[model samples]
Target: MSQEQRLEEQMLSQEAERRLSEQLDGAEKIDVDVQTDLLKIFQGQADGVSVTGQGLVMRGIRVQDIKLQTDSVAVNPLSAIFGQVELNHPINSTARIVLTETDINHALTSDFVRSKMQNFELNVEGEIVCLQPQEIQIHLLANGKIGFTGKVLLKEKGNARPVSFTAQVCPRTKHKPIMLENFNCTQGEGISLEVVVALMQKVKQLVNLPYFEFDDVVLRVKNMEVQKGTVTLLVDAHVRQIPASASNS
Candidate 1:
């Protein structure tokens, strides 16, 4: 790589690192061994999710803005002889978002609940984000991570909410294919991209961000002590073409 390209790459890497640090610095950790109480899952995160129609509309619930980590990869053939190409390798791109307590903290709990001597844990019958077509699932895994598939919804049954998210948790790009974009904090030539939407489309949000990502996510919060809900995810993408001269100078 040329010195200038090296410098640019370094800057991008630096920004990525800085963003990761900031995220970790501000993160409120949830212990994997400790199961948390129940909390509400918002249904309105659909806003800004797409430039299409307003997301699902419900009676008593609204989709809260959700934090997400997304990833997208593109595979292209360097050269095609005839109708056949040799091989295509995968190029992975990622993105992320951090939501505050006020953002997606529909779940709530307090230190007082943890203080319960005998009753160490209580299953909080968290409120469901009642709505028309729940877009996602309220997933409570065994590792204490609160999560949902692309089909965001709230069907928590005190024990665990049944997410509305289906196998097609990931949404697809309506206008342009998400697989054709490359993204960086700084604007450049990569194809048209939206990290957040791509994540929701792939139904693979949070797959890119490992720090906040839960392996076998679970709920550890107590019912009455619930104060905040922890939702972690990452988003990433790769563009079809970068204006070579603009980005690669």
Candidate 2:
């Protein structure tokens, strides 16, 4: 390649790295390590990128020690080698994501629900039920309730009972508070275990937290599954690229 071509390739690579670094700025409790090379720029290919990371702490939910691994990811050579980088094309990749039950519990109790129920004594737990192609089932328990007189009520001794709900994780949306859908629970005679309005409000607020934003990218959960006490999410994200002039500025 001519010196002019080499210089342009270096500029493209540097621009890509800068954009990625800006996207990950201020990420909480998550550490991402990514390596990229432009050795094949002259060949019109980007096949020298690898990513691996561990201990990604989810903000609203108390999930810690999340791990992500991806092998060498190939990209459109012409786009990356040139000044215009279009990531719209799908790149076949092998990846693995892992999360533990303890992380789920932490996420549930960390910010939204747990903080909202500070007036009442609350104990929450989550259990992964199944892992399949694109579905996840989780059983959640809230062991106490707030009384009418503004007092917290604990579970009774002989008849200890708790409010429990079964939720399924599905595709996420920008307007949705969480991936949990079709929430259902059991009820006894003359008793109704309905979700209160306050709880719903808190949930909405939780989903609007700052941690959910990904710079100019829109990220949504495409699928999720549970396996061996862990839940893994397949996320789909779209990045809004900055204009060339703005980036240059």
Candidate 3:
């Protein structure tokens, strides 16, 4: 058959193929993965949130940049290569980039994670991604709305970049649902600023990951101030840095 004919048939088809193929052939299982909770990731709007967080993690430069600047060092005196001390090819060292809120934002569950779409509940919508310099922040509100704001800081590894970003997960309802709280940025590098913006735009087009496929999970990881295997979010709670059995005297 001609390619044009195939195309025409596909376009003119009255009904899309009815389950062209079935997994497990014709067999079916009664067991299904029922979500026990709802996953939430607050995307607060520009003027709707009050942001607050600390203890930033380090997201250094890309390995590729360091790899390319290995011999591009400044050679002094007679050691200068070719007398003029030109930067050699294939230098490897550090990656200089404007680490903005967008970098951290992209590394968020929004762009940080690359998996199937998951479940998420949000109260507000943040502004489109942006970049400035040295400071990266997001506009937030008490209603859980947020707008990404801030500037680029670190430009390379060993850049002594003290970076961190966080927010409190205030669920709309009394009971907080399964949420990707303590949310942090993930691997960021390998693209130019323009590319990052464009990629972020693509992410906007794609379905938000945590909306459709994520199941609510409430596992308790050890909090720094809490004992191992302990999960507490109360005053004098270990996770909250308060002893469970001991109180300030």
Candidate 4:
């Protein structure tokens, strides 16, 4: 590459990193690699893009580490001149996310996640029951199983009762429904079989969604692994647009 070409690459890399940082709440470190040349920029194409980050927080959820790669991207040449990545068409990307045990526990307690868990309703024996998670902890185990211990308040007919349970979650293939196994009540009043069955069905439905869509992005899990102290997930994302600001906004 010529001197001018190298300089252009470096400038694009820095701008990519800055834009990625703007999309997150915070990060310990972020690196961006842009594979392109002046010729490709003039043609409104990028050879590829790779990003790596650690301790990244997005939308109040903290990730331990993440690596993302995109195939050739199509952009507007005008946007490139202003250091903006305006996609001309949807792009396909692969992402790997690593979450440590601590990250999981902290996310469970975060106000953003907790707010989503509060007052969750379930149908048990034709009665509308509200489930509010009070405390939850996750343990990554061997054999693709995750163990959880949590206390929840189950409100039925305006009366609330605390129920604590220990359970194991096992995910099958990407196409199969997640299995909730060995759910045992550890404290407080035990949950009934009917409620347990209902909860499991609810979990299966959520985990088996066709795709998770948000903010002009659609994500589908390609694979997942659970091991001691860590959980890792591989995802395929279809990006319609890149956010230029933090998720909270």
Q: Top lDDT: which candidate number?
A: 4
RMSD of each: 23.7, 12.8, 28.3, 2.9
Q: Quote model 2's TM-score.
A: 0.36
lDDT comparing candidate 4 with the true structure = 0.80
Give per-residue CA lDDT, model 4, range 205-232, as digits (tens): 6546767776788988777788888888
CA deviation > 4 Å runs, candidate 4:
142-144, 172-177, 188-192, 207-210, 213-216, 245-249
lDDT of 1 by residue, 1-249 (tens): 356534433443333333332322132321111011111001101001111111111221222322322122121222211111111332223333233333332322222222221111212233332212223234433343343433222222333232233231121222322121221222113212342233233333233322321222222211111123433333443322211121223
Question: How many collisions per candidate?
Answer: 55, 4, 36, 0
Ranking by TM-score: 4, 2, 1, 3
Score candidate 2 by lDDT.
0.40
Q: List the residue pairs that clash in candidate 2.
A: 44-77, 61-107, 62-106, 62-107
> Per-candidate TM vs. native?
0.19, 0.36, 0.17, 0.86
> How high is the CA lDDT of each candidate model?
0.25, 0.40, 0.24, 0.80
Poorly placed runs, candidate 3 (over 4 Å) = 1-133, 154-236, 239-249
Residue 184 shift from truth in candidate 2, angstroms: 4.5
Q: Give the residue spans of candidate 1 off by over 4 A.
A: 1-91, 105-227, 234-249
Error of 1 at 231 (Å): 1.9
